[model samples]
Target: MRTYSLDDVYETRKRRDSWWTVYFVDPVACRVALPVANRTRMTPNGLTVLSLVLGMVSAACFAANHLIAGAGFFYLSFMIDCVDGKIARLKGTGTPFGLWLDYVGDRIRVVLCAGGLAYGQYALTGDVSYVVLGAAVAVLDLFRYVNAPQMKRVREAVREERQEPDLLADADPLLGPDPLLGPDPLLGPDPLLHPDPLTGPDPLPGQESERAGLGRTSRPRAFFRLFRRLNRFLARHRVRSHLVSGIEFHAAVFVIAPIAGAWALIPLAALSGLLLLANEVFLVYRMWLFTRRHGAGSPQESREHVLV
Candidate 1:
């Protein structure tokens, strides 16, 4: 993994090599070109707004049956989306407000894009397959939003509980004043969507409890216990933490499912949702532990000085 810094924010090539190159690399270069092309200059949010506009235009193109044009515009819009953050970070103006805007804008972009695709599908094939796909994507997008706080909670829990140096965790760019995990006041009443005052919940059903107790009873849970032990051994030997984001799980499902057909994708999507649910459940448990052990407080207050 590559480490990032405020200085590297403006350094196009450096950001390119970070594993997030999938999203940020080309977009940063493209947005950086905006200033070089005209000395008048463009702010990161301006770029983000421009990108949002372009994304809308691209959606329109898709709705108009200009599939290639729409795809091209969407691609560019995504690039700008990526660039704006890089610019913000580079310029040392990556505020929480900007972060919130970025997250909200991403949802809007996904909705519009999916709507356009659904419309385009109807216009072209006269079948609602594309529309259904679009709807599925829209649903997934919402699920993604709802999942953020839970994922953040889990990562925070891992950081607090895991006994390792966690250089990878420490080097994370999404930490400090602008943590990737924060209470999104905008997400509204969905308890799972944002951190709320923790309250205890009922224990898991008997089977899950039994599964968890397997090792306690016999020193091994199941066949997977060996792998878990091996993983622990590796982490202990290497002195690093294993923190996998659930987004990676969705990423794989998103790419694989659609190509595999509704039958395949639907189940994968369901499974992914289950994983997110499980992640959230774990987060709740973690929150309880954190609060009880270290004085209860609002999530914002707990990590006011830190980031995820």
Candidate 2:
């Protein structure tokens, strides 16, 4: 009802629709209850640790073939996952450590869900599909981290290149007329146009110095200009935008879709894993293209200097 920032929307989404919610919708009111429960007591960090414990118990219950009960515990675990942040927000104790803990806890909850489902299937029907699917999802998480480094490097490089001199050309003559001229007007003479005694002679003795300095860049530099134009276009709308879309897909299809269905659960779980992995590969290719066009050292240096 009140005005909320993008961060608020993201926080709310993280609480309500995560991997934990996928397989566990027991009480249905868990989402509503989380914030309230958190208001009574406990820090976000405490709630996160509690959520992990609850998630483990939920997995154990599922392994024992207690479907409804396991689901219920899983739901509670998900609720706690939501509560941690709510509690942090309420107590005004949100911190980087709390954020990191929540992220790690969320991943662990997903693992617990996959493991619980597998264990449930093994107990109920002895099928190994769930376990295998769980493992696959676990492995796929690496993609997000893998592509992150490359993207970071690319972004850093772009930032530095954009920071290049604002003037159209790199070698603007106005910068320095001559090494010997030194800015003092009182100097014996403007050193720039003066012929250096050490050199044999100017190519064209009669012509002025400005005439001889007409062309600073060669053909290769012109080619770089064209490449820079293409790079600017891609950076504005293609590579980074696509990665953002992939992340949105990861949240919606993999996490939210399963919560919306029962039978769709397993399929969504598998699909999410694959999509996340594909996103990583896409990122790698994008970064590789950048590196090839620019240089690896440039990108790497940019990444190293990046504060984010």
Candidate 3:
């Protein structure tokens, strides 16, 4: 049998991850993953399958009104889900099929758990609100997953445009020079002076100064600056800035709510959903402002800003 260290397990972990996983899940998961990686021939796909099975068991527990048991099983399932990715990164055994399976399995688990919790509560109390709550949980979970990728694509597109040589030239008058490249003396004088044929003539002096002022004043608001500082602190601990993300949402609904008992479930879930929605909307608005400010150019020039 091969030997594996805790350090090795940590190395396989994501550089930036949800705060819930970083604080609540990863500590125990890394320990679990180390032994499994060393002692078992189980592949990442195998762990994913096990996680899915555990999730089904959790749903069954919830349906039976075994709330505590259900919460325990759900947490275990999620921990295993975390472990599989760690093992995949550690062993280089990740497959495209495994990725698809992981994604599909997560969706199925959320749907089943939501249905189970709602039905169980409704069965006990004969309240239709339980059903509504369950539906809301499932819908919100799906919405987050669906929307996150599209938002990520938009951010990436903006980044790509910023990096393109031609698009950068077009954006320079408004957004200033690329911080990474600094002034390229090799390009011969400044493009602001010579002006690229494709990009057209330079802006008026007043226009240039106005844009510069706009860029200067476009510094993030105080709240966002504080948020960024908090993220920087979290980064030191290998956690991402999204404090209440999908993982936390699931935890609030399935784990925390159940532990707090039936009375607390709806309020807790609602609050979690609202926070998640607010965070997402804030991100989308920021992206919109970024595009508006930096994306003022021809359609051909605009298309250049896509990242992978």
Candidate 4:
């Protein structure tokens, strides 16, 4: 068996990650994962299961109105959650099942904790608003997770579409005409064989004449320039632009809110939810602008382009 130092565990940390994880969690998690990586025989899957169990215990504590203890357990569970991924990367024992288990476990923990905290508070004060707050937290978390992957796919597809013409042009001189479409009189002399100098190559689809300028209003352009600068600064620090992500949301609702007492939970959770929604909406708007500039067309067109 190989032994790993604290440095080795730190090396497994994600380069671009939420601010909460980078500053608050990684320092402690690396220290904990160090010994587990060196001496323990536990696998990543085992650690994930343990984390889930701790989360359950945290929820139970919340249910009993043990706010301080519940907050402690929730933080500990999240620390363990961070450690599982570190161990997986350090040992190269990661599996598809492990990823799925980690994701599902996270969702379950959020649901349970929300319900427990809300129920405990409602039971104590008889306010139904707590119940609604709990549902809002769970639903927002789920919606973010569900939409993220599809948005990622759309971004990737748009990028590929923008690059496709360049790819084909580069290959045409060496590969000649595609064999299946050997000669099409209707399409005229193959553009590859007899290129027109005056017109230049047909502009990349959806790009047309606006490829150079990106057809952006001055205000949006300036905003994006500032955004890029901010992104670059964040990247330098190995943090992501999304400062208030799902991880931060959970930390705020479960750890900070509980410590602040029942009165603070609803307000803190609401603020966190709003921040999360703002970040998501900003991302969606960026994607919309990107697709418009790149000529991604419709969802069906993007799918067809990707398939091709």
Candidate 5:
């Protein structure tokens, strides 16, 4: 059996995980589960598959408005989602297939959960706002999924070029960022695209995370009066804001708002939509600025740029 310390598990995670997860959710969840998981022959992929199974069950409960069970399964699945990677770190057996499974599974699981919320609302109150709210949340959620990896690819590409001037020069030249990758098979088979494994779309390139201490780049230095507070705040907190935003927003509609009535979805949708608009605007502007500042150079210099 494999054995590991808490540090072994958590050290492998991204530095900028949600504040709540870092302090509360992940610590207890991953550490507690890892010991048991290590003792079993179960691989990290096994744990991920189990999480997906639980998510499916939770989705069913949500559709039926079985909030208690739905919440229970949802939390359990999330905990497992956190644990699987930690387990993989301990085992040293991660694979391309496992990465793709985890990525695709996350998107599918979230959509299913959101669909459940919509179904619950329609069943409980016969209101159509459920449908609208569900669609909006799905769009925003998918946007985030697409946005994160693509930006990461851009940042890492720049970093790589800086690190190896001789190497990148001999390699193929850089292509400017495209928010969307080419469509994957609606039905069948193909191989290589971007040679750099980090930019894969169907199964995104893996993230290399730093510690929170290393993650302080987002914040602006105090007493720097040039940029407005709002822009400064957005730059500083953008990544952290996204960590819990989707889950919390859905928890309201699927878990709390359901208690009020389907009508509650209307206001919730409005709030979510407003936030989505603001964030998208900020993201597009940042991307534009990043491309302009970097100007197809390989310095990987972050300077005032929120590339991702």
Candidate 6:
């Protein structure tokens, strides 16, 4: 209730929400933004829009081949991206609009930043490869986005089933005020720790059999056992993630891209394409596997299609 500069939003975040962000950009930004959050009229949605604007400007700078300036904006945008969530947590004014704003802003920023960098490189060097690379990144990025909401549901469902099976009758408990993560930060707002705000319609509730039993599946027990373990692994790991994580991709853009000079995106394109492909494949696999258990007529089957 005492929302003010005195609050250290970082203290309230989930451990898995942050790892590198906690180490690198956050401390300085938190010191600067906490007071602003207390004094300014900027809401979390405003911050989300601001971050997107900064990213666009940064991309413009990169397109013009201003590497250092682009990096400066990139980090600044990232820092503010972090700050918005802290403010949201501090003020406790998160809404679905703000959540969606934050999520869309992140996706747009990635497109602009990567595209701008590639175009700038091509402009400077007159190579079409950079242009191709940028396009490829965008395609992979789109593919990754399609599955984001689905993967999020799968993880949330799995996590909930393990913790409070009874409460899962309600739709994605986290989609509303998430008790597990606390106030959303940015996209994840939980920390890299953020939620992917791409929630689709919740899977329709089916009999208990849909979740764990396929009508005529060969081995219900073993199938569910493996399914739980796979889902658990995907949900728990911070590093690998299901795919489309920003850490490796961001590092490449901000670090490797600059260091490599004109060829920054060559490896980045490869990395992104592979990761997106893998993620889409896994998403499809999980959908098929889960739907099979739930049966074709079940609601989960229909819900999973929207995720695609």
Q: Best to worst by lDDT, what's the order?
A: 4, 3, 6, 5, 1, 2
Candidate 5 lDDT by residue in tens digits, 74-179? 7778778777766665566666677788878877887898888778867888888787777877887788667655655554465454553311111101111212
Score residue 82 of candidate 5 by CA lDDT: 73
Predicted model with the maximum TM-score:
4
- Per-model TM-score, in order, reads 0.53, 0.49, 0.78, 0.80, 0.64, 0.65
**Which pairs clash (backbone N, Cα, C closer than 3 Å) in model 4?**
none
* Segments of candidate 1 deviating more than 4 angstroms: 1-20, 23-40, 154-308
- Candidate 6, residues 1-308: lDDT per residue as tens digits? 34555446555333333334655666766785667766678888888888889998889988888887887788788888878877776666778777778878877888898799788888888888888877876666666565555555654554344443322221222235432222221123221222232221222567345544544553544454454444334436322233345444575565456656655458765775676577567556654554343343435644554355
lDDT of each: 0.51, 0.48, 0.73, 0.74, 0.56, 0.59
TM-score of 2: 0.49
Summed over model 2, clashes come to 0
lDDT of 1 by residue, 1-308 (tens): 23344345445322112222334335456555445324535677787788889879877876776656665676567667767766665555556677777777767876886687568657876876667767876786686566655545544544455433322122224324224433221111222222222222222566555556646533323432443444334333322111222333333333344345434544665675566556555545544444454442455544552343
| Candidate 6 TM-score versus the reference | 0.65
Worst 10 residues of 1 by lDDT: 183-192
| TM-score, structure 3 vs. true | 0.78
Error of 6 at 40 (Å): 2.9
Give the residue spans of candidate 6 off by over 4 A. Answer: 1-7, 12-15, 18-22, 150-244, 294-308
- For candidate 2, write residues 98-152 as lDDT tens digits: 7677767766765666676666665666667767765765555544544454455
Q: What is the Å distance of residue 134 in model 1 from its true position?
A: 1.5
lDDT of candidate 6? Answer: 0.59
